[model samples]
Target: MSGIRAVADGLVDELKRSLPQQRKTQRGNLALLVATMLEVRSANLMDLAASLPREADRTDMRYQWIARTLSNTLIDPDAVMAPFAAEVLERAAADPDGIVLILDQSKLSDRHQVLMLAVRHGERALPLAWRVEATAGAIGFATQKELLGVVAPWVPAGAAVCLMGDRFYGTADLIALCQRRGWDYRLRLKGTLTVRDSSGRTTTAARAKSKDFYLEDVELTARRAKTNIGIIHDPGHAQPWIIAMSDNPGYGTTLAYSERWGIEPMFSDFKSRGFGIDNTQLRYPDRLARLILVMALALYSAVSTGHWDEVHHPTPAEKNI
Candidate 1:
């Protein structure tokens, strides 16, 4: 068998173990597509069809097959991703520091945006849940809430989770949701938001200056959502880090906001660096979301393979010099 077919066979076996209820044809198609993606490292239909290990004589036939798979509404992205996401969350929950979840949004094309929730792994993140919308602006809090609601039950019971997000996600509604879910968070707030401390001192977050300052039990914005504020303005940065936390604010707690950068690299992997998903001609949001699912599964498989390889065959840099 060719290397691509070999990898596809392995993925088929793995998917079968995880998704026993999935139809055999669906599972095989998904596995083949994922393996083809890993090999081609692109989302271009022609490129993928050209390398597909299918019996179809014409490349166009194979391309149509891939399109049909993506267009099939029956293939639910959430259901397909559930087992993989559970494994990621289980591993993250095992860590003493507990699970760190990152939330962010990125532009997929001229008209599509993807709001993603990912679990931190090493220096990057693995996709947990996401919603792709056909919009030019932000995917609002309603969709954000819906995405979180879907993933909330999948988290291991009693596992500590710290949710992190950039300024776009630092809304009162999101804060309330995090509070309700009992997840610790370090969401960065916009400098313009109203902040009233316990002493009833009112000011904008932009006014917070000095090396580091912590405001305990503060009410944020017109909605007056209660939270703790951690402000950090280190040298050379253009803007201060105005972070909202569920616990007492401190330097370490405020600095935890840096972990949100993990999602940036993951986005790059999905776009330019690895899969080149943005270059694809997929315009329909549903089909685009299914395409992302293919990329997500391919990424999980690649990361898992690399981890196994590193442990069994250490690189020179990992070995004692």
Candidate 2:
């Protein structure tokens, strides 16, 4: 796979700057670890060693001793990526299209845990941030905060950004946070929540029209569920925001938000593919943070290299990177 190598090279280039020199692992070798992991899924250090290609495998490249060096080194992948996050986000600022972050949690029932994952929401979704915990409900306000902390520094000044979230972020506080951060957020609320409309009518899409702008505590009707919208402008927030948007503006903005399912398959690709990187082996708080960095690179490699479709029902023995 030329595609796989290209993705790994991209990661290597990114990681080359920040990996610590004291760890006795070379920057190139660290990058090779990621590439090697993705290419050979086996967790056994020995198998990985066997898979590292030698000079004989290719001409100009003489003696690429990836296996033995990797076998001996203490690999702290997180240490390798942390120094580069801010730069990565800064570069992301230049992305012609602002980055789309999909905030969601996936289940690892065998361990009875949930990991909050913020994946890049594009044709090939890749993770840019994450948080793993023992609770499924851990993906609430705290999780959103965690995702922002890691990526916020990287975004350049005035860089426009969008966040896609499910009903879990429907609460007023999370919406307010997005406003303060100058991030455009698309969040879903249950059809039944009430909000004070601009006209101060206790109306809902079930009863109001575009001529109206604000409402409070309204019932969700099948008709209102489509174009129904509301706004909240508390002075406490950094900025006021329109409550909802929809593709079927005819009905309302619900359909607009409903369309964010674009990232669903990307999530599925991770949990169900050769990216067996589904669990967090570290329990220390900061250590876990570093692990997220490692995973971001891994996910980017998967999408850029087109490995998501190479296997179904993935296991550690399948491949890694």
Each prediction's total of clashing residue pairs, residues at least 3 apart in sequence or on different chains, is 0, 22
Candidate 1 lDDT by residue in tens digits, 1-321? 989899989999998999999999888989999999889989888999999999999999999999999998888999988999988899999999899999899999888999999999989999988899989998899998999888888899999999998888899999999999999999998878987765565564545753437887788999999999888888898888889999888899889889888988999999988788888888899999999999999989988999899888998898865
Q: What TM-score, computed on C-alpha atoms, does each candidate reach?
A: 0.95, 0.59
Model 2 whole-model lDDT (C-alpha atoms): 0.50
After superposing candidate 1 on the true structure, give the runs of residues whose Cα lies further than 4 Å from its correct spot.
198-201, 209-212, 315-321
Specify the highest-TM-score model's number: 1
TM-score of 1: 0.95
C-alpha RMSD values across all candidates: 1.9, 11.5
Clashing pairs in 1: none
Question: What's the alpha carbon RMSD for model 1?
Answer: 1.9
Question: All candidates' lDDT scores?
Answer: 0.89, 0.50
Candidate 1 accuracy as lDDT: 0.89
